[model samples]
Target: MARALDVKRLSLVRLALTSAVIVLALGGGRALAAEPERPASQPQPTPPVPAITRECQTPAGVKTAPIPLPNTLRALQQRKKIRILAIGGASTARSGPDRGGFQEVFERIIEGAIKGLDVEIVNRGVSGELVRDAKERLKVEVALTQPDMVLWQVGTSDALARVPAQEFETHVGDMVRWLRAHKVDVVLVGIQYTRSLAHDPSYQAIRRAVRRVAQREGVLRVGRYEATEALERVRQGRQPTPPDPFATTEGSYACVAQYLAQAVTLGLFARRVEPRRQRPPNPAPAPAPEMAPTPPRPLPLPPKGG
Candidate 1:
């Protein structure tokens, strides 16, 4: 009786396990049958968004002629560094990197545009200085710094002082030639524009003088006057209220920096235009080779004796 009872308990446990297995198997089959098959959907790739570059943000009037900067380019290529000497009046006053200015903006633009390039800007700006004053200081600074390039923002103070246009031209032109002689490249940043000075004779004269010098010297010139004028016009059109002088001033500086970056980058890649050589006149086409006279073929044997 005891053996039979033990056998019965064993049989009951086995039956319970078997039923549990069958139930689980059925449930699993039902789950599989109830759920419909799904095809995996492939993800579509996203297109890259176009970057808004400084050039894209630049105003239409912010124009610059791409004069090649052989010295600066050479320095960049050799040392992976560009040491720029910035000298000017109020517009170019030295500022710390935290304080934004054209110099800082310029450095950022250039470094971002180029990989593995380092830019060091030495600012030597003195406010309320005339061309003569800055020129004197520039000579000293150039000697000490030995920079690869010189960024000279000029003409505003001289214009305000009512300096004679010819005198202004002479001072700037002389300094440019001197810098070139010293193997230092120069980019002339022209005067800042304002509604008050838009028609001022002295200011206009000074601006023209700078232009003439840049054209004659063949260096890059950032037309701050033109760019600012354009920006002002746009502002005037959009807003009826009086324009904010401070905002305009900031925009002017940003535009100047962008224009400078554009000019410098273009100059770096600009190829020197080699003067066309007098290609020797093609030697008169070799005299036509003389062909021996073809012996007169006897008339087809008179048509085979016709």
Candidate 2:
């Protein structure tokens, strides 16, 4: 009976030792897992940023950089002087009884607008000429001047001559293309309405066609038709019958001439008054007094333990 009791006690002791070993192993595994997780939760240090450098250098013996020339200044230096050549058809070529032709009025207006710039204006107007006729004489009338810009006022006689829209477009397009190829800028003038065709379907059609061609070709267009219509309204109120082109009266050809001159001049003036770009000023240098060294600060007190 004593030997049975000793064997049972030994079995209980062995079970207790096995359970202790299992608890120690589980606790040690948990500590190892927690150590790895703690490191993951901590933040990493940030890298240092690089400094930016400037390309342009400061002037010699000076801290501040010299101011750069403005775009407008640079552009002005490179700009070619503009020379304009005015070419008119029919009415534009005529100096009404008041001696104010489209050319004269336009020239005066443009001249007034460009103050310091060199500008030259020329007038080559011919009465009773069609597009075909103008094209034939273009070399002598326009190309000879070697103008930088050409103000072409045609299509009135062409419309009156019953020229087909296609043919008229062809002539104008060819003329413009040729001028552009030679580096000449162009502005197209639309046909003005006369008393005969003021309300005519064909007149409206002609004006529409000209407007489309001007837009498609990227040419500047003058609204001569609208101007004439306005003038007609004013004249109708003042006169019994529309004054003849050759007649000199208050509401006659003289008035029309004055209007044409003003319109053309204003148009040219507007083109000359375009805004220009300016450059930024250089930053001022630091003052000599500001560059002096700062005074030293008082030192902090030692910690209690130290």
| Highest-scoring model, TM-score | 1
Number of backbone clashes in candidate 2: 0
- On a 0 to 1 TM-score scale, where does candidate 1 land against the true structure? 0.68
Clashes of each: 0, 0
Please, what are the lDDT tens digits per residue for candidate 1 over residues 1-306?
Answer: 999999999999999999878877887656666888797977433222223344335356555776999999889878989999998866334344435467787888778776677999998877778888777778999999999999988998898889999999999999999999999999998887777777889889999999999999999898878877776666665555435332344445666677788788878777789899998988877788899999987764455557
**TM-score per candidate:** 0.68, 0.53
RMSD after CA superposition, every candidate: 16.7, 31.9
Q: Model 1, residue 46: what's the lDDT?
A: 22
- Give Cα distance to truth, residue 257, candidate 1, Å: 0.9
lDDT tens digits, residue span 1-306, model 2: 999999999999999999877877887555555675434545322222111112111122111112111222222235624566777655543444535445554454444444444456676766767777777677675557777677787777777777887788888888877777766667677786666677777656678777777667756665666655555554465556546542223333333433433333333323243457766777798667756678789799899899
* Index of the highest-lDDT prediction: 1
